[model samples]
Target: MLEIVLMHPDGKLQRLEAPVGVSLMQVATGAGVRSIVAECGGSAMCATCHVYVDPAWAGKLAPPLANELEMLECTSSERRPTSRLSCQIKLRADLDGLTVQLPESQQ
Candidate 1:
């Protein structure tokens, strides 16, 4: 299992242990993390699963694919250097302690 830490805008945090190979959206949504909406499931068609990758764990993840980058451009929130679509992040052993900050809004 891989551990993911999700931080809310108000500073609340949710720690989830998800099986490897699952998308971040799947774990977060299943855990009822209010930060993720996952409106399009894991299709990368919507920005509702947007999250800011913690700089400390940024290098641990793979670069975003073309489709994920395209979808992030449509997010209502400003995209930061750490911005990523949760649907595009898959859990892996190397990402055991992955940490992500929830965006202010997922509209």
Candidate 2:
């Protein structure tokens, strides 16, 4: 399993864990974390699952795909260099302990 940490805008931190091969969105939604919206599920068709990957872990991830880059512009928060769609990130052993910051909203 991989442990991922989510830091909310309000300063609340949620530590979550999931088996390898699942998306962070799946874990967050399943854990009943109130921040993620994930309206299109994991289809990459929506940007509601947007997150800001920690700079320390950002370089560890492969860059986002073209469609994910486009969808990210639709997020309810300002897009940053580390911004990523949670559904586009599949959990992996190497990504254990990854940290992300939730936006103030995910509309």
Top lDDT model: 2
Task: Give the count of colliding residue pairs in each prediction.
Answer: 0, 0
Total backbone clashes of model 1?
0
**Model 1, residue pairs in steric clash:** none
- Candidate 1 per-residue lDDT, tens place, 27-79, comes to 99998887789998899999999999999988889999999999989987789
Please give each candidate's TM-score: 0.95, 0.97
lDDT of 2 by residue, 22-105 (tens): 999999999998789899989999799999999999999888999999998899999999999999998889999999999988
Query: How much is 55 displaced in model 2, in angstroms?
Result: 0.3
